[model samples]
Target: MNYKLLGKSGLAVSELCLGTMTFGNTTNEADAIEMIDRFVDRGGNFLDTADVYVSGRSEEIVGKAIKKRRSDIVLATKVRMTTSSNINGVGLSRKHILDGVEASLKRLQTDYIDLYQVHVWDHATPIEETLRTLDDLVTSGKVRYIGCSNFFAWQLMKSLAYSDASRYVRFVSIQPQYSLVSRQMDREMLSLCLEEKVGIIPWAPLGGGFLTGRYTRDEPKEGRMTTKVGESAWINRASDQNFSILDAVVEAAKELDKTPAQIALRWLIQREGITSPIFGASKLEQFEDNMGALGWEMPTEIWNRLNSASALQDDYPNRFIEKFRRPFE
Candidate 1:
């Protein structure tokens, strides 16, 4: 239930952010509302949703759920996806951003968004054009902060540099897919965010339920991985390396008398530069299990074990650079 300042901003948010991507899809409105209530009762203050989630139904459900305590919540949503049939319906162009924000505000039933992020990079539009539009949103009091998701290290650095030189509002945070099984961020994005002082609110912090101990080596017959699509596909998550990492999590859970979900989440919570890990639950029991990640600290020994098990393979210039630094150390 602890709070941390998001990036370099004065805004404080909970250690865990509730993700509502499944709301209005796998979870109904009543259940979604109940989940929000329980989360707030447990002292959580961050909620993340995207306008494209479930064709805006997720935003509607979240809007209704948080209506009573709007002032106490830090709401975040994204744009930059195809939302209409028209040719100008997508991308970070000024037209799309302006239209998207208006639509998001209406659906969330809020006058201003706590954080408005571009869901992904829009190469079609000039970076300056995209940043200028976001700057206008802040200037008009429609958005308090801006951020990006699914961006490469260079894309983020380019945006930050443009903002600094143009005197525009810089992105204060980023949302990347990071977890014990998905440590690709460790390659470059992690260092970039750390050096730039940008907060990281990781999505899929449990690897889309891979680290939850629900699947086996035989392959999942059902659940998200069975779809064989996106990052959570059976092909992507069924690798031998990921299973070894999951074994480590399961072993830690057994030793500590905690659930596998808790062990995985705690590792992320304690990792340096991780502001908050966004977790989504389709059921109350799942949400409760994720909550267990709080209220206790994982022993450093176990933490190091999980870290070593999931560490990314050494590659390229980084290995060469490290070899050179060993003598100096």
Candidate 2:
């Protein structure tokens, strides 16, 4: 396991972060603790959870699992999701940010969070109010760093600009959905993070198991996608093009003698500006299998093949710009 500095921050984190969304949900406390133990044994020091996951039960499980070695882990969690029926129970408003951090700290059994992130864009609150609240958290030593998740290019840039003007601690990282089959981040957010020096910790790095090569067209397996069929993203991914991409992954895996999950993760880990890929597992084998992605290198040929198979076409003016640059090359 390798560690990289998170964006421009001095903090170092593992290349692969253990995600605990499954904790207290699909996995019981004992299993969750075992998974985390294995992860730590494998040299993983980063763990990510959200307060909203499993209605706060996930946080409780993670808290118990990491309590013995809390000092050695780079613990991260998020706010901005609805935690209660109260009208002030959500959003990035000052009240919620203050209340949310307190709740997360209590649940995680930690005095300071390694990284505290805003889970989603909250347009209702003023950016100044939100930034000020996060700044306060850092100043009070409750949060060591701050980040944002599920933010678009514009929203991130706007927040950064506001932070600069107000002299607030800028977000050191951004978490977005990115994978071999989900390359939408390559368009704008990737470049934005690169230019701004923000570390990217990608969640759903396998496209919610789409790139795992475990699902088929006729009969999807009983997994996250199958259980969440009502979600439009999952429904939309069950397309001919996506399956073709999966086939590309399977073919490469077969040629290299690696699991499709390893191939997908290795490719994402090698991408520029990605600090870590947050992966979750319900079973211990699944967690162990994902670790396979780290031991060796994927051949360049296979990597390129997977890249081409999942590459998104250049959008809009960029497509035209590529045409213009072709002459110079």
Please tell me which predicted candidate would have the highest lDDT against the true structure.
1
TM-score (C-alpha, index-matched) for candidate 1: 0.98
Task: Report the Cα lDDT for residue 21, model 1.
Answer: 98
Q: Against the unseen true structure, what C-alpha lDDT does each candidate score? A: 0.95, 0.90
Candidate 2 lDDT for residue 41: 86
Clashes of 2: 0
- Residues 108-145, model 1: lDDT tens digits: 99999999999999989999999999999999999999
TM-score of each: 0.98, 0.96
User: Which tens-of-lDDT digit does each residue in 1-329 have in candidate 2?
Assistant: 99999998999999999999989988888989999998898889999999999999999988998999998899999999999999999899999999999999999998999999999999899888999999999999999999999999999999999999999999999999888767788889999999999999999888888888878886565667765543224676788888999999999889989999999999988888999999999888888889899978888888888889888976887888777886656
RMSD of each: 1.0, 1.7
Candidate 1: where are CA atoms >4 Å away? 326-329
